[model samples]
Target: MTCKRALTAYPELLSRTVAAPSWVMPGTVRDNAIFLSGEVDEVGLCFFETAACLAYGENDLPEHLADLPLGWHVHLPGDLPWCDGGAEAAVPALRLMDKVAFLGAHRAVLHPPVGFADGAARLVAFVRAWEAAGRNPEDLCLENIRGEDLTGLWRTLCDLGCKVCLDMGHVLSYGQYGLLSLPGLSGRTSMLHANAPGPGGRHLSLDTLDGAGCGVGRAMCALLPDDAVVMVEVFDWEGVRRSLPLLETWFAAQR
Candidate 1:
């Protein structure tokens, strides 16, 4: 189903803009951004590969990226050097942030490093570096990833004033239900990465979610603030096409 059709069916979804990932098509971020802008409420610029994104160069991006009607946000790279005090990684991330400053992206999703002896301190250093770069701490949303529910860094997250980007696929696949109980989670969350886990660690369409999984997703969505974004988080256009109607159906059930 089309995004327009889903929104028409459940108009309340307008409050929380549903977004499509930037890699929906096998093309450059610029190409996918331009294509999906007409299909969804926003485009999630997937800067998952830091080296590739930086290699693509800022000037190569669409000149009118910020001028597009669809809103945008950056998904910071997954392989940041957070294990090493995060200073090295911060430079590239902030550079990417600067590159997309024209989009006026209010949110940027980050996957905090796990299994590090000083993970919390590293996270703090990362946030400090972000602030040191003149970026808003609240704009950085630490996502809940596999092997980490984010509970370990709860105090640090609160102390640093960073936000949360809850991922439903991770919650369901890894049984990260504890994320629901994080102190003040409802108030702190600014974005939701909605998807179902596929085989081999890939993201699947939300329609692949079962009854219990949908319950978890609903619970998470209930906690999101009114303006929080819900990105389909799938990499293919077909996945998004299938998920949009299901998401609208979920919204309908909530009402």
Candidate 2:
């Protein structure tokens, strides 16, 4: 019963702040892909500081990533709160979505704001905007944050015909109250932010998972459809290198 899934690496593996090599500049997506060449199935493009690329009238994959065989998935900017300013707040994410579509991304993972007063309405409006722009709702996946009650948000997603990006570290850190164990949640998951919880609440390499954490990750993987995407959301190459084998071993055991 082994499932075949796409394995992706987060672009932050090129972050200079994480002690990246002297040649690798922080936030350079192309260099990051070059560094990760031949090591992953796909690349997770983080749109945190690349607004220029998403500027109006620009629509193409960055030069560095243009020729790579690895497929692209998007991590929308973390600060955009679609529920705050209505469509204006959502414009950045929507613009990024256009680029995502232009670049042929598998999915765009978004982090919705927690505790917004009009969360559901804002989400509906946002989805309407997506529809208005002729974008496919299936390309969007909402991720769970650390401390929010995403029940209403999940409902909104289901209503909009969208899917979920389940972050394993977030589940372990904030989902102990039972969301992970709930029925049907796993069935809707289209992506997994496959990382383990480490000191100071950071995402550790997958190989560092304790027995219980490993079991949780393994169970989560078992629930995903074979074509789902699993992004190793770690910050360093060592972590990425260590994680690939752990995930491979888990997938191998599933057979």
Top of the candidates by TM-score? 1
Q: lDDT at 47 for candidate 1?
A: 87
Candidate 1 clashes between residue pairs 3 or more apart in a chain or in different chains: none
Clashes of each: 0, 0
Expressed as tens digits, the lDDT of each residue in 1-255 for candidate 2 is 211122333232221011111112254566676565455556687675446547624222454455665667778777775545556656887777666564566467877666678777777777777677777777778788865545657777887887788888988877643656555776677787888888797778888888988888887777766667777788776776677666766666666
Q: What are the per-residue Cα lDDT tens digits for candidate 1 across 68-105?
A: 66888889999887655677768788988888887787
Candidate 2 residue 37 C-alpha distance from true site, Å:
3.5
Each model's RMSD to truth, in Å? 2.4, 6.7
| TM-score quality measure for candidate 1 | 0.93
lDDT of 2: 0.65
lDDT of 1 at 245: 73
Q: What TM-score does candidate 2 reach?
A: 0.80
Model 1 CA lDDT for position 143: 95
